[model samples]
Target: MRHLFFALAPDAALRDAIANDAARLHLAWGGRATKPAKLHMTLRFLQGFTDPLPDDVVAAARAAGDAIASVPFAFELDRADRFGRRIGWLGCAVTPRPLQALHDALTESCRAHAVPMREEERFVPHVTILRDPKRAVPSAIAPLRWQVDGFVLMASAEGAYEVLGRWALRA
Candidate 1:
């Protein structure tokens, strides 16, 4: 089975800035720092697809992207928090409406394709900083604000998630 999701990737400059912030926060809080490569806020997680995504899935994702008008939104990195048992993440102080809308749209598309989705509670959008097993809490740093313009479709490959495509918001 394949795990899929939609997300926004930070550009090189922003990635560097966030890494620096993570480093400082790690030093202060005595937690392991997150690698810059894995920083992104997920819109939805479509779990348990038996094969590669069909064309309809790509079309639906593209349609969802086309429907969204680009808006200026910024995410500010907040303190560290653990979700449930094994996941650790950097909290962000940002309204989740945009991400939630994307999630709902994608979920609808998956349903339209007769793809079975993992049932879960309401979406609480978050960027993962660490995953699996327990990790120390990173210290609070001055929030890093980032502007988002687009989201990407990603798939699980060889035990790691890889980007499949990126869809930019229409102006």
Candidate 2:
């Protein structure tokens, strides 16, 4: 089974800024910095598949992409939050309506193909900084403001993710 999702990754310049902020935060909290390459905001997680994606699933994702048009969004770093014993993340505040609409469309598409959705808590969009064990949350992390022009389908194997396909938002 492969874990799949759509996300927006920071561009090179923004990534560098994020890296610096992450390093500073790590120092303050006595934790290691997040890998520069792994920084992204997951739009959704399509979970629990036993094999490669079915043709219907790809079509559904395409349709969902067609339903979403490009929109500008700004992200702000507010504070630090921890999730049970799993993760410590930097909280983000942003206009969520666009993301919510996109998620709804994608969910509906997946359901139409009879793809059972993952049983998990509702989606709350966030960018993770640290995972497992105790990690310090910096008093301030870099604030990121960028536009999400599209989403990509990604597959994860052996802890590494590869981009399967990217769907540009409809204009």
Candidate 3:
């Protein structure tokens, strides 16, 4: 069974910028800075198949992906914070409406198609920048703004992600 989820990732330029900031933060916080390739904001985590993912499940997920009606949108992350003691992350000071709408649309579409959604705590849109930091007190950072035009369905294993599908947000 593939561990699958939907996520939005930055372009290489923005990724490099984020990685650089993470490196600087790591020097102060003493932790592993996230690799540029692994930086992303998770949208939804889907249930894993008991067996290999069946064709119908894949179809339902694709149908859900295709049904999203959100257009390209932008958001900014202006502060750094930690989750527990391990996950040092960058997060928006406020959740953008378009981001929430997109998440809601995806949820509704998945429900319509009978795709099982993984149970998770309340969504907090964020991107991990460092892991196992000595300490990451809430601090202001130069804003990292993202123009989100598309998202991907990914299969995760062995610390890598494989894109199963990519969908452009509707305009």
Candidate 4:
């Protein structure tokens, strides 16, 4: 069993923009910025499991991905926030309804497959950009608008992740 989750990775152009902002923030506040390659918006975090993921679980995830009828959606980052002393994340002031719908669909799919998931009363969509920043400051940078067209199922191990499947959002 392997650790798995569903996430949305930005295209190269958008990744570059986010990375640039992270670099600037790092210089100003002194923290570890997220690596350019590791930046992503997590849709659903499925906790760790054994090495080979069970076939039923993978099928369920695929079904969930297939159920999503949402088209491409856009979200914009409007502020930088610190969750605590250690975590600095980029917050999206705009909540896209489509994103929520996809998340809900995935959650329901997990229930259908009996896959354990992280329980949360509310889902906050965020992309972490820094860690252990010395200081938190108001972010006045231009909003980073991201156009999300698809999502990927990723397997994580030893602090690294590999994309196992890509699902496009369609009508």
Cα lDDT of all candidates, in order? 0.65, 0.64, 0.85, 0.79
Ranking by TM-score: 3, 4, 2, 1
Q: What is the C-alpha lDDT profile of model 3 across 1-171, one tens digit per residue?
A: 667778898899888878888888888888888878988888888998654567787788888998887789998878888899989988887888988888778888989989989987777888899999996778988998899999998877667777888999867
Q: How well is each residue in 1-171 modelled by candidate 1, as lDDT tens digits?
A: 777777778888878876776665455444455568777777766655667766676566556545555554566766666676456666554555655666777677666655445678877665656545244554465766667777787777665678877766654
> Which consecutive 10 residues in model 1 have the weakest lDDT in total?
130-139
Return the TM-score for candidate 2, rounded to 2 decimals. Answer: 0.77
* Residue 20 accuracy (lDDT) in model 2: 69
Clashing pairs in 4: 1-50, 1-51, 1-52, 2-50
TM-scores for every candidate against the unseen true structure: 0.73, 0.77, 0.92, 0.88
**Per-residue lDDT of 95-134 in model 4, one digit per residue for the tens?**
6787788788878877776767767778778778889988
lDDT (Cα) of model 4: 0.79
**Top of the candidates by TM-score:** 3
Identify the leading candidate in terms of lDDT.
3
List candidate 4 stretches off by more than 4 Å: 138-140
* lDDT for predicted candidate 1 compared with the true structure: 0.65
Residue 59, candidate 1: how far off, in angstroms?
Answer: 4.6
How would you order the candidates by lDDT, starting with the best?
A: 3, 4, 1, 2
Clashing pairs in 1: none
lDDT of 2 at 149: 63
Clashes of each: 0, 0, 0, 4
Q: Per-residue alpha-carbon lDDT of model 2 for 1-171, expressed as tens digits?
A: 777777777778766766666665656554445688887767767764656766676566555555555555545555555666566666554436777777776677666655446655776666676666265543444455556666777766656677867766655
C-alpha RMSD (angstroms) for model 2: 2.9
